[model samples]
Target chain A: MGEEKGNVKWQMNQKCATIGFHANPGSKAVKTRVSLFVTCIVDQVFPQVGIAMTQVLERLGYPVDFPAAQTCCGQPAFNSGYPEEAGIVARHFLNTFRDSEYIVVPSGSCASMIVHHYTDIFANEQKTLEQARSIAPRVWEFSRFLIEVAGVEDVGASFDGVVTYHDSCHSLREMHIKEGPRRLLSKVQGLTLREMEPAEECCGFGGTFSVKFPEVSGGMARTKIESILKTEAGTVVSVDSSCLMQIQGAIDRARLPIRTMHLAEVLAGR
Target chain B: MTGQPSETINQTLGDARLQLAIYSATNRLMTHRAGAVRADLLPDYQELRTEANQLKKHTIEHLDHYLELFEKNVIAHGGKVVYCSDSQEVADFVLGLAKERGAHLIVKSKSMTTEEIHFNERLEKHGLEAVETDLGEYILQLAHQRPYHIVAPALHLTRYDVAEIFSKNLGVENEVVIEKQTKIARAALREKFLHADIGVTGANFLVADSGAVVVVENEGNARLTTSAPKIHITVAGIEKLIPRAQDLGVFLTLLGRSATGQPLTVYTSFLSGPRRNGEIDGPDEFYVVLLDNGRTKLLADPEKRQSLYCIRCGACLNHCPVYRKIGGHNYPWVYSGPIGAIITPQFHGVLKDPWLPFASSLCGACAEVCPVKIEIPKLLLKLRSEVTDAQRRQGVGGVERLAFGIWAWVMTHPRIYLMLARIGGIFLPLLPKVGPLGKWASQREVPKLAKTSFHQWWKAREVPK
Candidate 1:
């Protein structure tokens, strides 16, 4: 059992470094190390996003680490009004990445949950609240980390297509990530970045809101799709996969030929 | 009335005509409001909002003092102040006044507070005629329906619907044209206004220092409703007081611009008391009924008293995406949209309809557009927690609690988290499309799970040279 557990940890480290994350082979020296918090949705549904994020960061000369103990940021429970359950998962998350210098998440919603809401979840416990506050400032969403922290606008990426970006509500409203994704997308060669009408409005995924109020959710998705179609962009890109899922779901149902892609995937290039 | 918000929403969603009506009306209002608040009309809109918020905060905090001052000032200004603890008391007071004055007909302008008290229904039950003189309210009164939108009571009705209601109720024909319909309603309500024995109206703002009941409107109906009658009864909630008359400048500037994108409403009447001794065409007796039906309950909660800061601009409603989709009738209240979502649960309790708070997408649009900057999304979340706590106390939400409990446990353990994902990937496609999953899949296709998760793919891949 011990050997198996050790092997799993080793494999996770190997996985972290698979996408050219190491600057020098077997060399422990690097400018920075980032712990990847591949939010649960991207981890399971759109793993390419995680891969694309890793590749982009690795290319930026940062050694990335995927802590095997990291599971989720507990946004699902937190947003669903189960703060106690959210606290349990949040404390575990805080413990897992407690020692990391920089923690990066590919999802704006999850990143925001950690940065903005973790303190509220751990409000009853003073030590945990301080821990959350300390962890809060260090946590950055993928594109934001790329632009603000790493100070890289262009990642040597190229994608040939007309694309529009949806401002995920959490990212736009909570994290103020309006221009980061667009700035990066603008630098990509051969990519025509079209602006969709009401681009800042929500796609209405809203976590469990899609299932809880399916009709309203579906209605909002249709409204967003109509806005996307108006842009005449072949692909709809957003930083949050949860939003992309809702948009893609509506597009598929409508049988529209429009495609959805994560910002990381677009930046990682074809 | 309770626990049927979803049912009402579903019914409204099914009616495409009503949906279109609500969508276009609110869209127009939102666009107009946005244009009205631009630098040209109000360059320092944000500053004004902040000051307005501060004034409201101060007033609400010392609400008892301000209310007493307002009552004293009103009484000193020759107006009678009657304090009502509930809707019944308000109706009783109004009926008693009407009986003492030997009044039969009452003309009212748009007042959401009156709608809240069901004043018209109560008056009718007591054999008194209460006519809604505002065109939208007039149409709704004829149709026997509540106001659909806060600002636009007949917003859910199309010109055709109004024409139909007129033809059926008023024996008017060929008034399909919008202008002609307005003419028909104006002609019908003109006599009612002249013959009105008592004009009942709702106060938009009560100036405590000067004893002024400020009424803002466009149709001039409120002006007529307050004047042109022997007895003018102004029913207002105590939360509407501002400390001084000058405060109206900040509020008035924001109110019309946020409400309908107009720089100033056409008629802004300040009725301090009954007409002065020499004044012509003003009521002889003025009574201000201060209703505190569940308002003090909210005022007592320090965290939530900011809800009282609402100026009833309806800007949040116009800009709200959910309100645009589901419309006002789904809320089933005199006040609807984001403000309704917060206030309804607070006043009526979460058990009334546990879903009202969750009905919103929490997009924060409401907060962004709120003239007074009520943190609506936060309040919604707070109310949601209250609802969850209530559910917990009643031994409800067991299944959801269990699911979240298991989810929390799994998410804390990475090994189990990944294992469950892998298993779900293999079996989610095979699981029958039923229950909550089915509901999600019904309208939109569920995303297909990746064959190899990023971790698995990364772990098995060769390192770059």
Candidate 2:
């Protein structure tokens, strides 16, 4: 009974459209700004995806805020069997975003690290687990937040090219973000979506796995590159940047005629 | 790749022909499985998978009780049951019986358990002639290699390779045609099957209610192996039991579809005991050697015990991209692919094959295709922790720990991290490819950092409008 009561209070603190997450946000008007949790890869390597995401949200009539104190979600350490190291960084993430009403991330893997594995990272500490659980329901991957929570699609974006979708593993399986991203792509004015067979397979950029077993990783990526080429699309888009880096690297090595872009980058285009 | 240890990943990746053979074979199997179990074709498939998982969970949870019941029933049905703890014990028992009965030849069907124990090598070392009856296993035996894949043992071999192997081993003319080659293998093994003194096989499922061993195969070799010889012996892991005979329906329905996408295999034999008064075709003595080598250890760990629910369908192998990329022999054990990744480390210890758990990208394909609902990625993660923590305890991987420690320290401090990022953005392109970045660039180009980061752009453009 006591745990139930405590959960209800945390649920009320959720500031999204809510729906089934907490209390209904049906009639609520947004006064609080949406904070962006730009992943470490995006902040350093691919800032275009982050900017495009911010632009799309601002066009949706929601104010955006960038929390500068954020460094990373600690996924690389967490996935590579260094949980204590991941814990120290994940704790800082919890503190940095503790006061935000709504938080949105541009990458699926980072968002999953928070929503799915936070409990595991904080398993031994009850106090830290509570903090992790409270911020979990509030964290949303980019494509999912647009369709499911915000109840908006077709953010008036336009791109002139044929593109195929690459389903990053974490977003497709863990977050269940299928078709929603495609639905957003379909609304783009000049974008023609070509579906690739076996697009849901991994591109083999498994953090340290790429370096640890470079030969096998390269083999897996070559197969993925072949599948992408069969689509004959000018570009391949996905919800995560890590897979794009791997795919892009292989494409560059083979001197293939194609491009890889994050979904947020496609949406941010005018 | 300095800090990581490997057995044979580099060698496997260089063989493009072997990679294509594995990829196309697994792709064909995947297509067949998907079509056979489509939601429109089999509406109750999901429900059946759930039921099968429940049955396995219950049986494994009470394995001690169920194994006792099975042993008593086997005794009642005129068969004997023996429990062997390791491969040495198993070889000793088989060899002692062979010596007592004056047996000179042993014929085998396709039993991976025996392969796990290197049964043929031990027997031949003592000058006993043991022959493989399955066509795939026979070809592999001639080639002197382990299984390339679980279900399709010789899938990596082209017909040309087989022709060469057959010609060299049997001293026959080269036969590239598969049918003629199969005939050649059959002609060679027929004499052994008819005159061999004992038969050894593996059980797909063991029914406690009937005390029967169920062996499913597309070929008729297992049937002949069990009936053609006077003594029939089954070498099965202790984790292969089900509580009731009725549960066979669910597993039988799943096993063929998951393995080769057939409604059922060509032969589904339920062997209970020795020959009866009127049954002239059955074996005179039946023995089931239950193997426990390291299974009890898996049964004790609640966190990863779900690996025991595997029925060896090989569906996970067919769907695993990593296994397809690297082939099977690099796994350093008899079992290969996703099942081998989790099972080998547990059975053989992490210190021996530390790279097994870290071989995957955790893409969820193996778990998605697993008929028994084994959470492979989660178990792999757990095994990764075990391996890393073990290495850390022994102070063997100090460099890796220090690197991760520095990564965490930099990741927690935003100001220092931003300064480093700024420095990296300006000078990273001029820096030579070395360390981890150099390693990543070996196959692909390194990613270029943006001149202006997202945080920087957002900070400059936020006008409070």
Candidate 3:
């Protein structure tokens, strides 16, 4: 429909985004095979993130598969307390990635969608819940997988700018994936990391929360951007591209000099 | 009865300016607390909460025995413990102690127990200067106001507001930066901490096994307040005492992590008594004032006794949606949120805050995050029932009583309720957007219904079977 409207393209494009972090096939011993379940968001607005991910993954010596039919992980609907809508989304995701060796997601929100929301999403149906639980153990966020699972810290990329990381709420609190993005970021040859105080705070872009309670969401996001500005960093980097888009949108609206980037893009040295 | 609380929870609900103040501040705090706890690498977090609850419950159940043991231990360590039955008694005890010691300046850390007793004004009345040493408390002191948040007392003020207050009181100039403003406040409070004749503090926990008063703070003012002065007084509610010294670790782990979301607070001191001969920076006299002040009444009710187990970690306040929407002052008491909703009615009596218990959406989020496992929602429901029952007895010619009486009657009869619901379903849409019901409906939309009643529809559908 548009650059960022529907679910299907967003999921497809999110899968394409992870191609940027793939390992080189011939040069690597660890042989990290990853399936990119492009989250519903990247598949829609920023299909380029998916394309960039594919190119980055190939450059890093890994072959990434795009599970095209994936819709969503059911977190948005589930967290909103609508389990039935979430169930439809969860089964769609499971059927797409149930057989895959490893499922890596681009967003911590989506990753939490797989890890935590799946079981609850299918809680009523025993058979589906069992299958959902089976698929959950293998799901990992891209940054977490790149560092912890793939054993690749330096993606041999170079970027010359000052960037600070925003610890997304779900990834930082729920998944406990604090150091993964940092470990990958530390190896960016020309990049300088300026740590922001109270970086772990939510940007308050709680999905429908932005539209539903726009004032509260915008107010919280404004507070987050100010904290980013206080660090005097040229760029704000995060593993989840959605939070990046949110803070970046506010920054652009304010016409501040600061920029936002995905951890994968930074790691791929774009 | 003294200071006017918010008119109604409904009045304060969904006020955007207040929401901006509450949500932004609480979300930041929740994030900080989450980060600190994550850094600890504690695998058994759920287990830790369970252990904390169990320990608190056990300690509170045998509070008298533990208090006696704690008293004996304090005495053995050359410190004194005075048990007070009420707020007046506690104030009298502290005043008597201050008079006996010939104290002039009393540098006090943030103590909610002391606040509960209105000790600052009492001490000031007795010609003793009680200067608040905590940064947030210092800001409130300068502004001549009560605390808005438990952890961050000056949370309601913007930096500009603080600068204005400082300029007026300290005469440093108004347009100062945040750091510069803090620097001025620090410089002023540091002198008070050093020269104060008597220091007072609030204990986070009373380790009964050792008669120690544990204080946790990031500012380091508490350490200075308790140590630098010759006479040190720790005023804590009697419920603070825990049964064993070993259990301190479990509570402390959860307390610091849950309250501020830190791996550990910057400063946590367990003071047993006055400084020994070898110690250089220590107070000569130590006094632990165990204040009752309606706690014994709270302790008597088994259903409500769990309120006493509160470590004052401020976790409930952080997670509460109503508190986040309305701010703390809306609750009509010092303690607000789910915990406050339960305890306020008991302390103020059921007559004062009739609407306080109905404020919540009955979401069980508060009890989920509570470290002490206090069934806050259950207690709030209990309080609500008690308030309603009391109103039914005492509220003569009151519309509230009439409304509730009709509600009780309608709830008892399903057929009458169904008929009334059908009438309401038709007429509610026709009603004008004014008056009390309209205002309530404005905030929340009533769901549209099927033309037929559920019972009628079910009965018709079942006939084919």
| Model 2 agreement with the true structure over A87-112: per-residue lDDT tens digits | 99999999999987678998888999
Instruction: Encode model 2's per-residue lDDT on B1-465: one tens digit a residue.
Output: 432335466666777787788889999999999988999987899888989889989988999999999999999999999999999999999999999999989999998889999999999998898899999999999899889888999988999999999999999999999999989998999998989999999999989988999999877999999999999999999889999999998999999999999989999999999998887789999999999989999999986888999999999999998999888887778889999999998998886777788888988888887888888988988888888898988787788889999989999998889889999899999888887778788888888999998778877786665
How high is the DockQ of candidate 1? 0.46
For A153-185, candidate 3 gives per-residue lDDT tens digits of 787888998899998876776678788888888
Candidate 2: the clashing residue pairs are: none
Ten-residue segment with the worst summed lDDT in candidate 2 chain B? B1-10
TM-scores for the candidates = 0.93, 0.95, 0.62
Task: Compute fnat per model.
Answer: 0.66, 0.80, 0.00
Best-to-worst DockQ order: 2, 1, 3
Candidate 2 local Cα displacement, residue A100, angstroms: 3.1
Scored by TM-score, the top model is 2
**True-structure RMSD for candidate 2:** 4.0
Q: Which regions of candidate 2 fall more than 4 Å away from where they truly are?
A: A1-32, B1-8, B463-465
For each candidate, the alpha-carbon lDDT, in order, equals 0.87, 0.88, 0.73
RMSD of each: 6.7, 4.0, 13.8
Using DockQ, give the best candidate's number: 2
DockQ of each: 0.46, 0.69, 0.02
